[model samples]
Target: MDNIAGSKSSLTWAVHISVALLVALWLFPTVGLFVSSFRTADQIATSGWWSSLSEQESQNPFIRVSGDQVQEGDLYVIEGQLFPETDAEVSAWGTSSREPEAYEPGAVVDLGDGQSLMVNEAGAFRMTSETDMEGTRLPRVFTTATTPPEFTLENYEQVLGGGNGTDSMAQAFISTLTVTIPATVIPIVVAAFAAYALAWMDFPGRALLVAFVVGLLVVPLQLALIPLLKLHLGIGIGKGYLGVWLAHTGFGLPLAIYLLRNYMVGLPRDIIENARVDGATEFQIFTKIILPLSFPALASFAIFQFLWTWNDLLVAKVFLIDATGQTTVMTAKIIELLGTRGGNWEILATAAFVSIIVPLIVFFAMQKYLVRGLLAGSVK
Candidate 1:
């Protein structure tokens, strides 16, 4: 008992540490991307998100005067370019919504010949001259020593609002769903029927057929893309949703049938035999007894096929083209964004997170069945 308790304690500690590390690993980049997505382009370029919580530095441009000095209550005013001479690269800045940057806490600037000026980082400036100079305008610049935290949601708005210069993934997301849903559902429906027949309907060469389907699983999907696409075009189904659906259904069927068959064959022989004796048709047995028992397998396969079809870019690219580019799916659109707006990390992060939402939903919905399905109709 003591040994078992000690082992359990060690296991608990290990699991806790492992989970903490995993959470940190996952959260670090995701949080950075989330914060970066909400910031301006220049802010993202200049500072890390960790710095956004504190003060920052910035700059401003202004003007100065010459040949006049004005004294306010015994303070000599001297003013010139506090900012850099030219538009050079800024080194650092502070961040605070109030006061921003206060140089000498409200001191005055004295220009040569008795002119003076003062300004805060809030674009507020002051100037005085003992006597007016000949020139009409004086030039000056103010450098910002600091600023405060800033954020924006413009990146997400552009991605979802359908007006970011290109066709937004809003349409592509729906298009992917249109392709993925049916692609996942059809194969499972058809493969379930096929799996049932292969498992229970004793027929000639059944062994050979199962072997063939199993063999197909090892065949790389890339090997068949060109040939299958040629067949699609030859059949006049070229480059459309229907063609892509059929392609994915075909690709997903082998494993679907194999997995469903294994699960189905494990069903209790006596139950099937009793159903056969009770005058229930094969269809009746399948629908009533097998399907409910097979929920886990079906749910598991649904998750796989759904995720694969949802995330597919290469297949959608080849088989779903159209004249108006209306058929492009989210994956393809994201790839296009990577090529076109490669520098925009906000857009990239938004696209990635958007693409993941559906898969995450599907996983959560079906996760209970994933393990249950694998063990379905087996123990009994």
Candidate 2:
């Protein structure tokens, strides 16, 4: 009874657990990136995204007090707030880095030569000196503070450039779309025709051709890159959108044909026979019958091609991107940001989220077709 065919397995719980784990593994970083994109640099550096909603308590770097000294009854007074206008509460304060938390909030420290400094939990500070001290160095304060959660759209402003239109990811985004749309569509179109021919047409060398395409799947693109590039150069299509589009088409075709051919071959033979019996030409049958029915497979290939070309850097570097360095894709722009603004994590996160959002939308929108398409010819 337990081993009966078509009955649910007792270990189905294991499969469910495995899938849940995989989803969590893939989802955590993406959600973190999305959350961090809305966060300020200080907030991101201080706490993880999971804790972003709560108050953050961390030891801040030292801040040097700066303000003009006021003369009051022969004594010099310097008054200021370390975290002016913010809701951060200083828990502990210290005058020296070595003893950063030596003093509790509101404790007063006596400096030599008739000077005294007092810091409260609200981050307000006042320094008093018995003698007039106009030309004195300021004291540095190290503080441990608890700050309220902060979220901002400034990261988006910097990445998208709002409206000023300079040094923004917007241009790179458009360039990426320009490259990816053509790259994805061209291969799908060419492969559709080829796949249908291979699946339905009784042509010579069909099996061998299918074998060749399957073989090409294992041939890494790197092996033929230089030679193919040289061919592009020889044909006077050197280093431009057209060259890159053709290159992506060639590189993406094998898998496209293999996938579409397999799916198309699995379609009911009776349908193709009926269409041909009614005097429907191959093109008519393909456009009307095959294409409409093969939507799942087409969408599956589209998603894969779109993702690959959108995130591609190597091909764009070699085939696109002229010497002026004016035409950069989003991936290349992000690399540039990493090099130039390495410490600005907020900017990187925002730009990364911008790049990822489109792909995520595409994936989720077309995901229904994905499994159906990939598994089309596997069972029957």
Measured over all alpha carbons after superposition, the RMSD of each candidate to the real structure, in angstroms, is: 7.0, 3.9
lDDT of 1 by residue, 1-380 (tens): 33685588878788899999999999898788767777766566667777878766544333333434445665434343343323233332222234334345245655566665565544344566565434555634444545456677777788878675483778888898899989999999999999999999999999999989888877888887889889999999988999999989989998799889988998889999999999999999999999898887888888878888998888888778676788888888888889988987778777777887778787777778665655542323
On the 0 to 100 scale, the lDDT of residue 109 in model 2 is 90
Q: Which candidate gets the maximum lDDT versus the true structure?
A: 2
lDDT values, one for every candidate: 0.74, 0.88
Global CA lDDT of candidate 2, please? 0.88
Which residue segments of model 2 deviate by more than 4 Å? 1-26, 68-71, 130-136, 162-167, 339-343, 376-380
Q: Which ten residues in a row have the lowest lDDT in candidate 2?
A: 371-380
Clash number by candidate, in order: 28, 0
The deviation in Å at residue 258 for candidate 2 is 2.1
So what's the TM-score on candidate 2?
A: 0.84
* Model 2 lDDT per residue over 194-258, tens place: 99999999979999999898888778887777997899889899888898899899999998998
TM-scores, each model vs. reference:
0.76, 0.84
